[model samples]
Target: MSHHAKDLLTLAKAVIDTEIAALAALPSRLDDDFLHACETILACQGRVIVTGMGKSGHIGNKIAATLASTGTPAFFLHPGEASHGDLGMIVNGDVIIALSNSGTSEEILAILPVIRRLNVRIIAMTGNPQSSLAQAADFHINTGVDKEACPLGLAPTSSTTATLVMGDALAVALLEARGFTANDFARSHPGGRLGKRLLVHVRDIMHTGTEIPQVPPDASLQQAILEMTRKKLGMTAITTPNGTLLGIFTDGDLRRSFEKGQSLHEQPISALMTVSFRSINAHNLAVEALNLMQEYAITVLPVIQDGSVIGIIHMHDLLRAGIA
Candidate 1:
């Protein structure tokens, strides 16, 4: 390789190595102080206000987002903006998380007096535990690493990565403690794929009403095949005299019957159908339907309610909706 290429590879490797080492060194830092920070945030009735400067600000913004999404109500405030008049956003019941690798971000420190006056408890994340911000904090978290990924050792790299991970750790710990469910996560992420996975129900995607592929149990095999073909669900439900689902017959069963020399026109679907096939509830989650299909080694499941066939769901439907 040319010298330029080799130099680029070396720099990339150095950056990754610095970050990996910094993360590996974080386990020992999870001490009583981390628990104290979580406890403080949990006790706060208002939102979490995170602020920092430069790259720390960027990491703090992401941290705030993660916290908000995982069940904690949080928002990011620029320290400079707070000093300029945005400090009104912070409430007395709120908790403040301030990030400064050196523990002396001028912008963040400038607003400390005002935040203290508001009486919002502050948690400091810094490299220097003895710095002014750290000393003044209600609880201090050490996000310090031995060095930066920058070759000149001046840019924020490993320190930022460590801070972000620590923030996630805190958010996830609080998430578990609060019994935050997937439904709660979906409410916060209604526009994202995660929301779709959690919010969309089986009835939302299942073929209902006339779209349901169903036939009476005593119906001829030919009639069941016609229902399957019309619905395009690759399967037809066998219903009892009272409209309760008795069994289901799919293309696989049709093929097996043909191989057994059973005449399609004369055979009864109830005799040919899989009598003990798995069924799903229309009110269940779409994700649950996906799991049922996978576990039974089948591509289709009949959705039933009160023993009556209400709809049918196929693996293709789940995939097309991005659930699988």
Candidate 2:
């Protein structure tokens, strides 16, 4: 590497090493206060209100968002704005999480008395264990870092990262305490990939009615092939006279039959259909359907309901639904 490049790498790694050391201190700092914070939030009837100033405010916003998405009712509040009447957002029984590195931010301290008057429970996260904020709070969780990673030892770097990690730890602990599940997470993120995986059901994207390619058990192989071709699902369900699913014939079956020089027009499709096949319910998650398809090495599956073929789901359907 060039001389300048080596210097840049050295400087970057120094900052990373400093931050790592700070983070290593966090695990030993968790005490009774951290446990109380989790318990208090779980028992809270109202939402969690996080407030801070400047860089702490930025970290506070992200912490609130993570808590909210993970099944905790929470939102970020700006301490400076609260002094001007935004404090009206606070209510009785609400849990307050205040962030201040010095534990002496004037903006946050200015509104602490007002918040206390409303019966709010305060949880303070700060670098100083002996600061006024820690003394005033009902509970205290330390996010103290040995030093900042900045060359001047003034920037928020290591301190802010330590605070952020502590916030995530609190949110996740509360999430586990509440028994939050992937389905619960998907509910809060219906537009995200997790929603598509956990919330989208087979019925949501399956082809129903005339769109489903199907033929009676007595139907000729020629007829089944025509139905599969027109439907473009690479397979057709072989059902009974009353539309009960008996078996299915796919392109693979056709390829094998062709190799044997079988008469397509004379043979019944049921003779060559797969009897023991994996079928999924319409109410099942689309991701489950994808798993079934993968396990069986098939590209299409029949949706059975009341012992009849109700719909058909294809691999292309899962791809289009973003569940594949």
Error of 1 at 198 (Å): 3.4
Give the clashing residue pairs of candidate 1, or none.
none
- For the record, the alpha-carbon RMSD of candidate 2 to the native fold, in angstroms, is 1.5
Best model per TM-score: 2
User: Residue-wise lDDT of candidate 2 within 206-303, one digit each (tens)?
Assistant: 99999999898888888998999999999999887788999999899899988988777776888889898889999999999999999988888899
Give the per-residue lDDT digits (tens) of candidate 1, residues 260-301. Answer: 997767668888989888888888889899999899789999
Clash pairs (backbone) in predicted model 2: none
Q: Go through the candidates in order and give each one's C-alpha lDDT.
A: 0.91, 0.94
Model 2: lDDT of residue 192: 90
Evaluate residue 194 in candidate 2 and report its C-alpha lDDT on the 0 to 100 scale.
Answer: 93
Clashing pairs counted in every model? 0, 0
Candidate 1 weakest ten by summed lDDT: 262-271
lDDT of candidate model 1 versus the reference:
0.91
